[model samples]
Target: MGEVAKIKKFLAEARYHHQEATSVDMVNVMKQYKGLVSNLEPYVFNDGTCRKLTNLSGTIPVRYKGNTYNIPVRLWLMDTHPYNSPICYVAPTADMCIKVSKFVDHNGKVYLPYLHEWDASKANLLGLVQVMITVFGEQPPVYTKSKAPYPTQQAMPTASPPYPVYPGAATPYPAMPSQAMPQPGGFPPYPSMASETPYPPAYPPASSGYPPPQQTPYPPMQPSPMASGYPPQAGVGAGGGTITEEHIRASLLSAVEDKLRRRLREQFSQGTAELETLRRTNLELVQGKSKLEGLVGRLDKDCAELDKAIATLEEKEAELEKGLGKLSSEEPIDIDEAVTTTAPLYRQLLNAFAEESAIEDVIYYLGEALRRGRIDLDAFLKQVRALSRKQFMLRALMNRCRQKAGLAG
Candidate 1:
């Protein structure tokens, strides 16, 4: 089949541009599109970049009502390979004027976020195209000629081209035969009362309960007293009797009902208009909510990354503090021989402190007692206190010992 060769050619082109594509990825593309596509063609751009095109004209699952039906889908791939996402449309029969909607617009543009966010580095061409096909299966666009909000509601009459009149239909009174037609008068000559053209029924049938009373053989003529004295009134009905007050009352009631009916229709039309406006408003709100939720999800992900970084920093701080503690805890400061009266005992203390394992038994216990007794005072004050008290005591003891030794000599 031509279609099969086209797919093979497309695969070859895809492999050519994407040299890094793995064998497994190529196999996946071939297997996935075995018979799903019905047509394929290729074209080149002005810059000589090759583009692949394909269409699945067979039954693609399209949803309507509560059922999914097969429909044709046309697709066009970008000339720049995976770098450009494909553009798709749902093409119905010639007689079908597709409805404009969220899924498919008047121009047949399909709305799918995957195509909108296509990334050449990540998205596989075969998989992305498959996604596009599956999108229509879930909730297909509703195609209707009316395409009005709340379609089940009453349809408001809109201006439209006139349709051909059918035979036997009540038509407007025809103009008098050319010879009988009036030239100067704005109105057409009235028809013969003797003829049977019961006035053309109202343009729109009367909505009131009662029918309009038939013409009483006269135009705007009231009963004349001279004719009332006789058996027949001048403008009375064919019955040739005096007109009664009841006829007048009945005609007046019909007029009132017709006026009320027209007003009711106007109010109904206004309400439907308002409902359409509200429907659009609700749609806009839904779109804004979706965008806001997407932003919040991104923010939450960023916050999680920041929290991990902060935790890593805290762990590093703990390790650094432990190292500093070990260095300071193990060493003792050396004192000058002239300043210490403790003699060789002070020298022995400094040498024992230098060897990490020298302190034991009584020596370790005494060192521990001295360490526990020391207060963690302010650095400047603690240093002053250490030097003044201990150094003064050691110096005085050394002077006394020297004097004693000299006396013995």
Candidate 2:
């Protein structure tokens, strides 16, 4: 088996032994060494590492002891086997060497150490080697064999037979062997050698020197019946034992006249029918046009009536507006006259009272004037100014009126 195949087989066994471990442990291991393993981490854990090594995967560079080491760690873990034990290695330098100082004692025997310095550059390389060994067994043998250079046998040339021909026919031949043979169920086969002419006996030589005869032109042909001495017929004569031309012409003229008469009758009948149809159509059209005219006239009359009604309404509206304006103007004049007629009597009664009674009478008259609708605002204001001017005159008038009436002032 191939080295890669054996390594894969070892890894499968190792993975089976480690199958009891949780997927998290595998993932943690891969992630911790991701700098050494790179993108293989997810596949190693999630895909169950056994399958990963079968594909002969790439390496990730891990640094240790101030040097970068390419560690061959199989992604797969293998079960312990007696014959082909799995093995992995970390190369200290480009050339792989084991450093004895970095070895760690496990169970009293020295095994390679785990890198614990936490210094990414100075750690154990043997740890990576041990991990690989735990996964894939030791490498397999390499085989070296070379292949032969060129092909041994060469192709040989062959000639084709002539095509077979039918008994009475000629055979046309191809010039070269590379030309395709005529297929069966196509044309007949070519001629055999017994029927074929020899190359020397085939065609005549060009130097025979005898010329061929020239061809003559053909004569024009004459009409047979006239050349056989048959005379031409005259008009109205029964020549050639047939009917006379005049009778044939008369029959033809009669047929033509009959056809013409029938055509004329048909044309007259069709004209009469067309006239009747046209009359009916004209009547229908006239009726329809009359109906349409009546509808149009009705529409026009209705539109005119609507227009008249609109005009009448507009005139009435204008008259009503004018009447309203007249009423509005006359109303204020009548109100003014009514106020002028009633207001003077209240003022006279207020002036005739004594001083204290006059104040009360003036207030009463002012209220009565307001209530009776006898005081316009402008006139009431003028009356208040006039009363102020006549305050002493009004007192004298009150005294006189009290004396005349014999009442205490």
Candidate 3:
């Protein structure tokens, strides 16, 4: 290769990138954002802030979780478009209510970590959508099909020069030429040997231009080990060579199956754990209820016994009241005779009741007179003599009553 060849190659590469940047009719806007444009009808670059008025669309089939979900997107370029991230939205279907989620709101406002940490100098529309597919995967969109499962989940986190990797591009984001089509899923299927090497088999014509220059003589081509070997080479051609189409397809299938299995296992484990916990909690609740019932039963028994005791006491009170009523209805007792009769009874009771308090009962009536200081010496002597006579009377009364009882018996 000569200096002229290097310059030509550089020019060709530059031309290729230029065409990619302006694939849409809105070259000014597309050049700035490098978006995949959806041109509506007559091709024209939209000049104003009103993005809808422009004949452009950025629809793409986003692949996620092994499902190809078609995300029809529209870009609303801002007045300060390149400096700031554009307002993007995924159009809703007429039949389905779009589920509001962290990444995409019901009204279609996206809240992505990339957007939160946006950098205008290096970000582009293609990169934005690529990241959208990833954020949406965390909580996937409902029911439309995506182009394919993610090219590589690991590819999503990279943000610098975050353009979609076209067939030849090194970066993970979508920066491929428009020839890139949405197959069943994924940006581009793994390349074959021919695609793995970006240049064609034949060399280009020598460059005629000057300012930029490059020249490196090409070496003769050799047969790929893949085709040369007895069996096809391990990958593409050699063991460590670029990924082959077959390998990509096999990997996708295996990944889908593995994801499904893992999901099922997780659901089963979670349900089983919940059931065990519920059973334990239920056991505790039942035991607590049983203990409360026992305590209530004991209280009921005690209440019933108390009620019976009250009823028995009530009966005794009623009987005593009835006896008193009958006594009141009968002739009034001669208090004097009653006193005379009860005098010996009191003495017998006092003698029989031998507790220490019996002596205290003696001074009961005399206490008032002593407190009043009403007894002079003469009065006290007279009262003493009268008390002596009463004692003699009590002795006669008891003897007479005993004789009568003996005769009657």
Clashes of 1: 0
Q: Please tell me which predicted candidate would have the highest lDDT against the true structure.
A: 1
For model 2, residues 7-61, the per-residue Cα lDDT tens digits are: 4444454364433332323334444443333122223333555333221233333
Per-residue accuracy of model 1 over 185-233 as CA lDDT, tens digit each? 2112333221122222111111211232332312232432323233332
> Which candidate do you rate higher for TM-score, 1 or 2?
1
Give the TM-score (vs. native) of candidate 3.
Answer: 0.29
Per-candidate clash tally = 0, 24, 25
In candidate 3, which residue ranges exceed 4 Å CA deviation? 1-250, 336-409
Question: On a 0 to 100 scale, what is the lDDT of residue 56 in model 3?
Answer: 35
Model 3: per-residue Cα lDDT over 1-409, one tens digit each: 7433433343343332333233322344444333334332221233633222222344444444343444545654433434566566666554333334445554565556676566767776557766876665544433333334233233323323322322533432222122322232322233222212322111111110111111211111223233333443333432544334444444445545655654565455445645654665588789999999999999999999999999999999999999999999999899645643346655553333333233234334455576688666566556656665665565565565556545331
Higher-lDDT candidate of 1 and 3 = 1
Question: What are the lDDT figures for the candidates, one per model?
Answer: 0.47, 0.38, 0.46
Q: How accurate locally is residue 149 in candidate 2, as Cα lDDT from 0 to 100?
A: 15
